[model samples]
Target: MNKKKLIVVENAIKEIAKRDGVTVEFVKMQMKIAMMNGVRSTDSKAKSFWDNISGKGKILTPEELIIHTSELVKQRKSQE
Candidate 1:
């Protein structure tokens, strides 16, 4: 990850860890598992959606998903 994204992810992980009473490493592992599951999903739409956001043959990181979603929300609000 780039410096900015790394910082954002670190802060987010720390907050999640504190609220959940878990270590930052645990949060990171969960995120990796979730991403891997998404990438390995058999459902066509699920796979396609991931491919769309992550690009073909690429795995999407937590931050990338957040960034994509934030951009989408901003676009929708601008259209309102």
Candidate 2:
């Protein structure tokens, strides 16, 4: 994973854990669940990976968020 995304996820986990005063492991598990819930890309392999890791019955990651966002932006600009 990229540094920025790694930081985002790590910070998110920490922030949530701190707010609830939960353990780091609990935050990590919650993050895995959130990621699975958020996965929405079309790549089956990616989906599978996310699903397996998250235990959320999904296979996607927020890491792809920026990647797909830029792709859509490029596509729209091309059409315009």
Candidate 3:
């Protein structure tokens, strides 16, 4: 992550720790749990996405497939 984003996350953790009267370590642990949950959710969504696309009964023409593939590539590149 970038420095500014890291600073924002650090500040958030500090605020949470202060509000809950907990140690920074405790806040960090909770953040870790939340991050792990997010990772799991992403993994599940990716699996479901592939499953939905994979079992499609209709076949595409070569041109159609190329267009679809290009669109997917563009989408992935934009996210990066």
TM-score ranking of the models:
1, 3, 2
The TM-score that candidate 1 achieves is 0.76
73, model 1: CA deviation in Å?
Answer: 2.6
| Candidate achieving the largest TM-score | 1
lDDT of 3 by residue, 1-80 (tens): 24564565567668878999998788766655653444345587744543443343343332333344456889999999
Tell me each candidate's TM-score. 0.76, 0.40, 0.43
Q: Residue 5 in candidate 2 has what lDDT?
A: 59
Alpha carbon lDDT of residue 77, candidate 1?
100
Better of 1 and 2 by TM-score: 1
- Top candidate when judged by lDDT against the true structure: 1
How many residue pairs clash in each candidate at the backbone level? 0, 4, 0
Evaluate all candidate structures by whole-model CA lDDT and list the values in order.
0.81, 0.62, 0.56
Worst 10 residues of 3 by lDDT: 57-66
lDDT of 1 at 16: 97
Residue 20, candidate 2: C-alpha displacement in angstroms: 0.6
Encode model 1's per-residue lDDT on 44-63: one tens digit a residue.
Answer: 99898788888988876677
